[model samples]
Target: MKIDWAAIGSVIGVSLSVTVGLVALFTLGIAGLSRRERAAAEGNGGGAIAATGAYVCFAACAAAVAYGIYLIMAKS
Candidate 1:
């Protein structure tokens, strides 16, 4: 019974990168919300754009999570 070290390493690398990317995406979403609030407080007109971007980020994150779940439950 031989082990596939390369396959294991590949999986680990992909998993780590995806996890970091997802976290960063979520963080950006949070930052967008903060910016939108600040803009609103200052009576700026950019709040709507920022809010829209923030919602898009959140939707992307949700879609990614849903795709991952689908992959896990998918049959080959």
Candidate 2:
């Protein structure tokens, strides 16, 4: 059987990029949370914005995971 090297490379590249993107998104969520806490301790109005950003990041990550699961289960 002939190997489809281009298809194999495409899959590998996509997988690695997605993995890195997810990790970076999650890390940003964590960093936003940390900044929120710091702002809260400093008695500033910045915490609210940071908290909102952190929640948005978390939601995006959750949605991405759910979509991935759905794709696997759909098997279409």
Candidate 3:
């Protein structure tokens, strides 16, 4: 069997691009949530719930990206 390096590279590049894009989105979401949380905290309001929810969402996004990368790598 022969390896098609070009195809492999294409798949890897696409997968990485998707992963990075999703991560960027998640980062932006987290950043926005953090800012909101800070504002709420300074206003004498509880922000822990919102902060925790943002962390959970970020983790979920990371997991999804990892799963997508795994699928790409597993493809023949």
lDDT tens digits, residues 1-76, model 2? 9999999999999999999999999999999999999998998888888889989999999999999999999996
Q: Write the per-residue lDDT of candidate 1 for residues 1-76, one digit (tens) a residue.
A: 9999999999999999999999999998999999999999999989888789899999999999999999988954
C-alpha TM-score for every candidate = 0.92, 0.95, 0.54
For each of the candidates, give the backbone clash count: 0, 0, 0
C-alpha lDDT of all candidate models, in order: 0.93, 0.94, 0.78
Shift in Å, residue 59, candidate 2: 0.5
lDDT of 2 at 11: 96
lDDT per residue for candidate 3 within 1-76, as digits (tens), equals: 9999999999899888977877786886687588667878699456666677677778778788689779789995
Candidate 2 lDDT score at position 33? 97
Best by TM-score: 2
Please list all clashing residue pairs in model 2, or write none if there are none.
none
In terms of lDDT, the best-performing candidate is 2
Worst 10 residues of 3 by lDDT: 44-53
Clashes of 3: 0
Residue 8 lDDT (model 1): 100
Give the higher-TM-score candidate: 2 or 3. 2
